[model samples]
Target chain A: EPEVTQTPSHQVTQMGQEVILRCVPISNHLYFYWYRQILGQKVEFLVSFYNNEISEKSEIFDDQFSVERPDGSNFTLKIRSTKLEDSAMYFCASGGRETQYFGPGTRLLVL
Target chain B: AQTVTQSQPEMSVQEAETVTLSCTYDTSENNYYLFWYKQPPSRQMILVIRQEAYKQQNATENRFSVNFQKAAKSFSLKISDSQLGDTAMYFCAATGANSKLTFGKGITLSVRP
Candidate 1:
């Protein structure tokens, strides 16, 4: 089965530095999403992207976060300034319908 | 805002036994989708099964089945003949007309040998 793929399975960055997480969604998927889970917390929605624009975002997705579909296959999430609390497992998902398929996830640790 | 609640934080079952994980949600939308995802120690999210709110028939995938009660706003997962591989953190999630998924805190299931 085709699945969503993400790059840099794990990343460590300085607290004030910028970080970009990349994902390659399934080729035929039209909708993409980003979600994060703190070490011991529930998964939280970050943003949803469709037609090269943001469809919806959560309150947690503030000024520091931005998503881009720079190419037909690549979808990236950029954090302008990482905070210690920004450390978490970030997941990328894509879907043609209601069921979204998820990637393995990228573990981001901002120290 | 929509919310998913998994009342059981942890559960254990003997190998080959049947186990049920409870999940309930509060949603105002009449049409939506419910899902059960499994994350093992590897922390990789895996879609186990899904149920559509409009469908009255419960959704089942092999040994994994769901008891969905639309009126009560309940969707629970039942794992039959549980194996050791079934040990994982299970999350119940719901999505309304919007595509965003609201997930429950999760329930850890340990299938003992």
Candidate 2:
């Protein structure tokens, strides 16, 4: 089965540095989303992208965060400046319909 | 707005036994979708089963089945003939007209040999 794929399975970055997490959603899926989970917390929605624009975002998705589908296949999340609290497992998902499929996830560590 | 709740934090079952994980959702929208995702020690999120609100017939995938009660706004997962591989954290989620998913805190299930 086709699945969402993400790059840089794990990343370690210095606080205040910028980081970009990349994802290649399932080719035919039209909607894409980003979610994060703190070490022991529930997964929190970050943003949703469709038609090259942000469709919805959570309060946690502040100015520091931005998502781009630079190419037809790549969806990337950029954090202008990383904070210690930003460290978590970031997941990328895509849906052809109501059922969305997830990637293995990228673990981000901002120290 | 939509919210999903998983009251049980953890559970354990003997191999080959049946286990049920509870999940409840509150949603104003009449049309929506509910899902159960499994996250093993690897931390990879995998879709185990899904139920559509309009479908009265529960959905069953292999040994994973869902008991969906639209009136009570409840959706629970039942795993039959549980195996050690079933050990994982299960999350119940719901999405409405808007495709953003609201997820519960998740419950950890351990299958004992």
Candidate 3:
């Protein structure tokens, strides 16, 4: 079965640094999304992308966060300045309908 | 905002026994979808089951089945004849209401040999 893939299974970055988490969604899926889970917390939606633009974003997705579908297959999340609180597991997901298939997730560690 | 609640934080079952994980959601949308995702130690998210709110009958995928109570906004997962491999964090989620999913805190299931 085709599944979403994410890069840098684990990343370590200093505070105030930048990080880009990449994802390759299923080729035929139209909608893409990003979600995060702080240790022991529920998964929270960050943003949803369709038609190469954002359809909706949560309050947590502030100016420091941006998503891009730079190519037909790549979906990326860029954090301009990482904060210590930013440490969490970032999961990239995609689907044609409502049920999203998630990637293994990138564990971002902001020191 | 729609929210999914999994009241049970952790549960355990003997191998080959049946186990049920509870999930409930709050949503006013007329149409939506519910799902159960399994995240094992490998940290990979796998779809265990899915259900459409509009459908009256529950959905089943092999040993994995859902009891979706639409009016109550409840969707619970039942794993039958569980095996040791069933150990994982189970998350119940709701989506399609706003094109985003609301997930519960998750329930950790441990199967004893």
Candidate 4:
């Protein structure tokens, strides 16, 4: 089965530095999404993308966050400035019509 | 708006036994999708099963099955002949027309030998 792939499985960055998490969703899936889980918290939705545009975003997805499908295969999430609270496991998911599949996830630590 | 709730924080079951994890969701949309995702110690999120609101027949994949009650807004996962590999954190999630998933605080399930 084809799975969503993410680069830099683990990353450590200094506070105030910029960080970009990359994901390659399933080739044929139409919808893409970003979600994050702080250590012991429930996974929170960040943003959803479709038709080359952002469909919806959560309040947590503030002005500092941006997502792009820079290429046919790559979906990237850029955080202008990282903070300690931004440390979490970020997951990328893609779906056709019914089910969405998830990537292995990238663990980001802003120290 | 949609909210998924998994009331239990953790559960344990002896290997080969049957275990059920409870999940209830609140959603205003009449059409939606419900899912169960598993994250083992490896920290990889895997889709265990999914249920579509329009389908009255529940979804079953291998050892995993779901009891979906559309009227009550309940979806529960039942694992039969549970094995050690079944030990993981299970998350219940719901998504409406917008396609943004709302996940519940996952429940940790441990399969004892």
Could you report the DockQ of all the candidates, in the order they appear?
Answer: 0.71, 0.73, 0.73, 0.73
**In candidate 4, which residue ranges exceed 4 Å CA deviation?**
none
- How would the docking of model 4 be graded? medium
Per-prediction TM-score, please? 0.99, 0.99, 0.98, 0.98
In candidate 1 the C-alpha lDDT for residue A92 amounts to 98
lDDT against the true structure, each candidate: 0.95, 0.95, 0.93, 0.94
The C-alpha stretches of model 1 lying farther than 4 A from their native spots are: none
* Residue A21 local lDDT, model 3: 100
Q: Clashing pairs in model 4?
A: none
The clash tally of candidate 3 reads 0
For model 3, the docking class works out as: medium
RMSD of 3: 0.9
TM-score of chain B of 2: 0.99
The alpha-carbon deviation from the true structure for residue B103 of candidate 1, after best TM-score superposition, in angstroms, is: 0.2
What digit string (tens of lDDT, one per residue) describes model 4 on residues B25-92? 99999889999999998788898999999999999999999999999999999999999999999999
DockQ measured for candidate 1:
0.71
DockQ (model 4, Cα): 0.73
